[model samples]
Target chain A: MSKQTVFLVGATGETGESILRALLDDGSFEVTCFIRTASAHKPSVQRLKDKGLKVVFGELSDSTENLANLLVGIDTVILSIFAFDVGVEASLIQAASMARVKRFVPCGFGTPCPRGGVMALRDLKEVVHDQIFTLHLGYTIIDVGYWYEISSPRVPSGKFDYAIMVPRNKVIEGGTAPNMLIAKKDVGAITARIIKDDRTLNKRVYVCGDILTQNEINSIVEEKTGEKLELTNETTADVRKDLDQMNRAVQDDPSNLAHKYRLSNAQYNLSKYVRIDNTPEIAEYLGYIDGRKLFPDYVFQKFSDFVNDLAAGRVQRPYPHVSL
Target chain B: MSKQTVFLVGATGETGESILRALLDDGSFEVTCFIRTASAHKPSVQRLKDKGLKVVFGELSDSTENLANLLVGIDTVILSIFAFDVGVEASLIQAASMARVKRFVPCGFGTPCPRGGVMALRDLKEVVHDQIFTLHLGYTIIDVGYWYEISSPRVPSGKFDYAIMVPRNKVIEGGTAPNMLIAKKDVGAITARIIKDDRTLNKRVYVCGDILTQNEINSIVEEKTGEKLELTNETTADVRKDLDQMNRAVQDDPSNLAHKYRLSNAQYNLSKYVRIDNTPEIAEYLGYIDGRKLFPDYVFQKFSDFVNDLAAGRVQRPYPHVSL
Candidate 1:
């Protein structure tokens, strides 16, 4: 385990810096950064170098021999790179198996999926995820679901504002009160802790950075920014229509869908991860505290901060869902 | 042209071998083989080394760096490697563009496609093919219909025992030919010609090794071998039935249709490549005199030859397509 080396792709991206800092801050693991050039040296790589981690640069078109020099001693890999197709994950996994790399942590940092949730997908990530069953390497997808860092600002988001794509008008059959939200820095902290802990090895670690319900966030935003973030809580049919509308938007713009894995999920299961009671292993992970209990008031604080930002027009507006 | 170096993946695979021989035989092109070995000796590598082709091995899991080294001093690239995932082909093409490789030829060495043929597939290969539009590199996919290779006498094929998987009786709807067959040697020849020909530089060059029909092959086997061969035609419905039944059989069996890609293609349209008329490019390349004009006596001769082999037990009998 001490000999395991982690190769990081797209280390300069948004989420990469957190993982890089986490991995580098801990001295137990060795890390390698696969960069293309020193011409546009990323501060992260320099930081990793400054902190005594190895950095390598190479082309993806070159032969295996040419790149062999870089992967010589690597064991684990953390990939966050985004391309036109996330299906490249499978190829990378295949290559990793060929190279005899041991463990892999894919960029599945989504909500900790229910077992069935992962199986229902036929998307590129799902296809690649399925291949893991046939390969010899061990993989643990750290589903730090919908990081607080990346979610839409809920503060100033009110009646005039949309309900974060989920419906606000009708009563959700189950209602959306269970999920716990987490800050991105907390996600980074959890990631560092999980990897550093031998107990979590080969286990699906559900790290809800801060646990707060969508309802709580909404209420919090209404309180903080006084904006009514009206979710279209219509009939089931209407909810489905809205979900379809969102999905259609993503599909319409392939470049956008490609970037985010064509999200706009059809399930309308956005708040599904609100509760960590979903996983028995998760219950066991922290002695059954479940994520929400850990951060009881996460949404109100996060949403308030988000509303402050929205008031300043700090974040980009919702992209129009046009057909591709 | 003299300074143009070409990179070839799958250099030792069946199609790669042909492309390699074609590029090397041209004498005007420089060639490099990207292999999987890291300073390890492989039979294919030795052959290429003997022919003065540089060999570079790059892991698919690592960064694109290995490919970049070969990209330098290279102006054109013939990517015969089949990276069947979504972004891999695009990424490599993007790398080629980055490397400034002017001309790129993808491994599109199969029959010309209609709207729904392989061109419409969402698989990794199609994903890579789609990248052609996004990437600035000049690219062409040479579509060679099925190749018919003559087996050595020592390992000669017995009887007219060739198995072509088609979607039920609708095989003709898809690009795959139910009747037409191409010789393997001709496949090599045609692709070699396509690579060397300036006329097909940007277009799909199609070629058929021979214009023989499926029924003719079966009939010829009876005539040639002086034996009766049992033919089993599995319709798409029958295949689906079997596949559904053998869903459990695929767990341990390799030949089960339950898990085979062939079963999944039962709904595919296969008639396009079956008809020689659909492929004017290949028909032109072979100088077709038309099957109707030359087949009366020739069919009898070929059928008899195939039949004699079957009678002699030279050809292996096919398994019945019953669900396991």
Candidate 2:
């Protein structure tokens, strides 16, 4: 069979880069990535181009006709842009549909943001999902929950700037609420495998590395670090109170970036992270018998491996993407 | 006491125009309506300006700094813009907050759109609500359900061009499911009264004329028009089936506007119109004991009155705003 042509937007971003690398390594599809010319000088863009991947330069808000022209003959269009660029992402969806792309994957690689909570990004993601549904594009939404790199305090990636689940010396909200977290590279591999899979078409797929509580994560961190670190337990109510204060701070100084950061972190703690007891229940909610059971052929990386990678200095400590 | 300086956005649109008229007639608030200069030559703008109404020309995406400067003395900001202008609305919310406006009333004049449900506009409204909540802006969300002028079949307002409730000879879906319908004028009057009322601050309010089924609306139309219209009953399941077909049609030919119209109408039938037995339950949802019991002093125009007004050529059947 002839190889399918895939167009990926935001290929320089963390999620985009991971997915792009995974797809390229698979060598089954002809991969093309759209990058902003403004960031063409970046080393990441040069690295991707050097890896024998096709690269195109354009703004996210490129005219629909122009975007459609670029998407010509592409079988799938995967948008992995920042959630805040919802308008741009919407335009891309329209353009992809206009170009008659058979499949479209939006940047929904987290919890299902069904409603707007304190996080504007989550709300915007919800809006994007709505737009995709209304446009009736042949789409697949991947809700992979949180990533381990940011949540694991041992690594303390720049992306985890919000002290959500710091390895030590942090208060974990709802410490015992079993939550799902996947390694970022694993997300890339899973997405690459599913892009052309018919089962994923017009559906939402939930994937994860491990399902464990914050306290469990803390235990894992201690085992890897070989040192005891301070850990505090905070109730959900305490987190909400902080969110309320952050909300006020945002209102008082709308331009303050720190207040926005605090508000974002507070919201993620209060709503965005999903807590599922077991794989079966989560799989049921995701419209499957069990995600792991369904994908028996694929093996996800373990949290211990992620911890070892952090200790060995193999994991990227400073995330290149903008903080959420 | 000096009148509150109210900055009104989209004051020339259907709901906005109605609210503007109500506020002007009351002569309580010093009303200022923001209008895009591209539409400055429109007769609506001229008419408002002719009536000594303060008209400011600017884009919705005018930098927040510029918008804040314009809103320096405004006590409240009321946004009744088209639902499709969500990006613009977000900018307005930020601008309003930056301006330190005391209260904000977003374009939540219809049903409450809590999440994305096959409707992009509803999802956008949800995002706007989230933005308002996150910003900690003092706000009032008015869920007035459906407007009688548009939803009533005998009067086919241009705004209801999507064939939701048509002028006779149409199958009404879920005819027995009760819904709250209010006159557009009443929405304006009620909103005008509540803009400055402390009771409405930071809360959602549901106001309605009558809670009745589509069959009842058809009966009222027949009673007023003195003509027995050909009406047929259809189930919500039938509507969902049509929506599914529309969804497929849109996927097949994404640019087909007709498919979009069909999908929009089907979604409206399935979700937009409220289904309730009585006012008290709806009141509970809107956080009130009972809307009627709470607002005993305000008299909402009856469905019979609406029908008579339509038959007597008092109701403006050709809506000035674009169709949803």
Candidate 3:
């Protein structure tokens, strides 16, 4: 049988790198990475090229006709672009439709956000989802809760930085609610399996490595590292106050780039700590198939294991800086 | 004070004509109508031009740069385009933002649809609304209820056609749900007042000329026209059946244009007769300000008055055919 050809965008980012790695390691499908001309000469992109991964140079701002020509004969297209670049997805999706791609996997690798939520980011994501559905394009939407790398306690070593992660010793609102978390590598492996399986076509696939609250996560880090970190409880009211201030700032100056970024940061934190709508039950209610149920034999890396890796300095920093 | 400069799209459309007439009659704004090259020479377009309305030849498919150039010096931009043309609104909106227009009124001149309804058309409209809000542009969203011209009993003289309206002498469900109704002229006048009021800035304005059930409307028409039209009840189950069949056709052949149009028509019917989300109470809960409350002194044309007009042959068919 001929190998399936996959086209990937945003291949230099952390999640995109993991996906590219897994697809390459699977060795069953041909993989192509779409990179911006500015990033075409990076060492990481050069490494992928050396590994026999085909690279295409182009920008998302390119015309739909041009992008469609680049997507000819591609079986599936995976998007792992940044959230801020979401507005451009319309033209890309239209290009995919014009190219007659078999399936589309959009960049929705986050919590299960119901429509009409407080997060404008999720609303923007929903627009992309709706557009694909309206066009009758075959799609598999994957949302893998929060990343353990971001939710875990920050390593004290100066080698790694946590720009947007929660503070080191803060527990948000008793932190008893069970939140989903996954390793980035698992997201890649699951995505690889999902794309190869016909059962996941035109469905939402929810992936989770472990379900742990903020307090439980902290407990694992403390037990694994023996650091005796002191924790403080931050009330939901405080979070609401901060979010309100950020919202007002954006409202007062909608065109201010800095204020918009700060507002998005506040909204991200709210989705992680204050919103309880991302639970497994809610996901099921929203018609998502559990990834664990789909691939029961595959073992998942636990949060405790990640904590041990951080304590032993065995975990490499994925990126220099993470934006919310 | 100087008159506000307005740029209008869909000027030849029925709703757009009313809005244009209202704005021109108010004498408070200078209006420019954007027309496609094909429509530029039409008699309707000629009439608008004869009335001293500035006419610009352009298409929605125009590039954002080109559209922005046409919008230069315009204070507010109003869209009254058809639902199928919604995908083109993004570029036009981006152009408006680039031109730094003070206010934008999107093409939402229909029922007050809440987010995440059964209607795909409404979902598309919500995407436009979200885009405007995300851009932080000055805007007001307007949703009038069902149009009296479309929902009223058909005139018997064969002067008008009801291709997409409810079948003659038929009542949907119990026909007791108080649906909002407005004349096209009222939509125009209310929109004119809304665009001029600072209190409606960055808000949703719900407009209604009257609120009546299908049964009440039938009785009024029968008494006024004295044409004993027998009414048959169409159950909600039958409507759901039709909608489900249309949905399956679209799903089976998403690329079929005919199937898509049929599905849209079924969805429009379902939204009008099956959904209860367009009520004034629901709109209020969704944070919409009532237009009647905003302008209590302006007498609106009631449904009864519209029935009398139909009986007297004083009403004109706004368009040859209304597409769902």
Candidate 4:
């Protein structure tokens, strides 16, 4: 009957920040953010501390002993950190298990990685998931296929400074894959609810604000903004081919840090948008059924709702650059 | 055209060693084995060197500049290393590009890693594939689904130290998924041919010795060996559930080296046998069609031929523990 003490990693990013706000607003759980000590001086961290959020200093890549110390007395650990080493999440999971955290949620706020597909980001998720599963820890995985902000100018990851799949003037050719896009705020709210709801324990939980196709999204943008953005007719195959070429280029010149960054961005984008064939079956496969059927009591915010919110300026601009 | 030069990585491995023998026997291409400097003292490396095979000492994880130096004047680079760091192959790829190696063959002699699947081995393959593609390097991906040695007592990879799927007396219950398996010798022969044939450039070259379901494979063992192994009635679902649990255990204690090894073996076995549903379409998808029909010129060693060879003591008993 006691309030759960929450330890949150990746508290500075958009999703992490949103989740933090939701956890604080819930007023039932005690929230603590585990951030890198070096980045603790950032304004965002300062603001969170000012809001009475407990901020712990630690790096995910740190030794398990140190991470365990950080997770002590924390009932739940929610990770929203970006991918670093493949072992980072595994290390955190080890620490949480040592500390005996009641529930652990590793960052999965995307599509369910295909069972045997290769995609570094998705594979990293798999590695972490394998470690979590092997450890017999109580866990929850959130699968939000894509973010609407991918189509917005202000990027959350900040690696890709512009829109990827659905930029202002360009839509991928045959952009009809049913995109299960979720808002950062919705992700936060839903995650907070799931944390409170014990039913989601040790299971893969699905969260999506709306399921919209690229063509449908393009049309919605036109309606909302009163302009037709350039809809480029490049296919998913083209993106994959180009990704392959660019990656080779990176290999050719390991000194090209810019190309490596570009490769990373492309890899992330391809995993998010191009890898999975866009189909209703895929949407249904990626927890659309579970998201709707399991959480019958909760109403999800729709893509239209998000667009309407954006059009009415009821919400802040879609993508806000979050400082480190 | 001048005789092509091949810089082969992992020449001491089971498949790598076989490929090396075939390439040497061909006498058309100039074959150079790029091995780790640390492994230069291994008997296998010494034997290859004794055979007048060019054994170049350079680790795949070496710097691009150094690897480039090792790959200088190499016409093609073929990687046959086991799953290791994602960057190792990428580093070699960078070197190959720098050295202007005309063709690069990555290690993908297994089930196709689904585009966004979480399977770690497949994901590693994906990572290597991405680097190859992004670099705009020439590539020939050989997807040989599974190896027949999984049922053989003589395992190639000494780490597992035992037959994984086909234990002496057990069979997965309802094991009906058709496994597309190939012989290491066939793989060697076909690869050598592919290297000589310019038609296979930049294409996904499929190769299969045989495709058989677990039930069929079990029956074959019974017929060939005149012994009925205990047919354990475990389902794919069971394997997956157990994998999930075992993975959780690994997460709980990341330092448990045995657990990590078991987890890796479990992952590789699951990807090879359990993950994909045994549908005819999937069989076609994993290169069965192209392997069986596309290359009429190449005759693959059949499963029957392999069993007969084993019966006659023509093929060396599998799972030979080669000293490093």
lDDT for A283 (candidate 3): 68
lDDT of 3 at B270: 67
Worst 10 residues of 4 chain A by lDDT: A154-163
Q: Write the per-residue lDDT of candidate 3 for residues A248-314, one digit (tens) a residue.
A: 9989998776677678757766666776656786565455778889989878899888776666666
> Which docking class does model 4 fall in?
incorrect
Pick by TM-score: which candidate is best? 3
Candidates' chain A TM-scores: 0.66, 0.87, 0.92, 0.84
True contacts kept of each: 0.00, 0.21, 0.00, 0.00
Q: What's the CA RMSD for each of the models?
A: 24.8, 15.6, 17.2, 14.3
Runs in model 4 with CA error above 4 Å?
A: A1-324, B115-118, B152-168, B252-261, B277-280, B283-289, B317-319, B322-324
* Candidate 4 residue-wise lDDT, A1-324, digit = tens: 788899998888767878888888888889888888789789988988888778888777789998999888999999887544335776788999999998888887766544334455666776676667545577788777667665443223332232233343334557655656777677887788888877677666676767776778767766666654544576667777878987898899977755665665566556556654223344333322355566677677766666665555455443344221
Q: Lowest-lDDT window of 10 residues in candidate 1 chain B?
A: B150-159
Cα misplacement distance, residue A55 of candidate 3 (Å): 54
Clashes of each: 81, 1, 0, 36
List DockQ, one per candidate, in order.
Answer: 0.01, 0.09, 0.02, 0.03
CAPRI-style grade of the A/B interface in model 1: incorrect
lDDT (Cα, tens digit) per residue for candidate 1, span A1-324 = 454578887676556666777776676667787776752376656775786667777654445555555666677778765533355555566667767766677765555432323223324444455465345356655665554433443333343344243223333433454554555555555665555445444444565644555566566656766556546443445545655676676667755643233243334243243223323343232222233333444332354565565555553333224222
Point out the higher-scoring one by TM-score: 3 or 4. Answer: 3
Leading candidate by DockQ: 2
TM-score of chain A of 1: 0.66
> Candidate 4, A65: how far from true, in Å?
42
**Total backbone clashes of candidate 1, pairs 3 or more residues apart or in separate chains:** 81
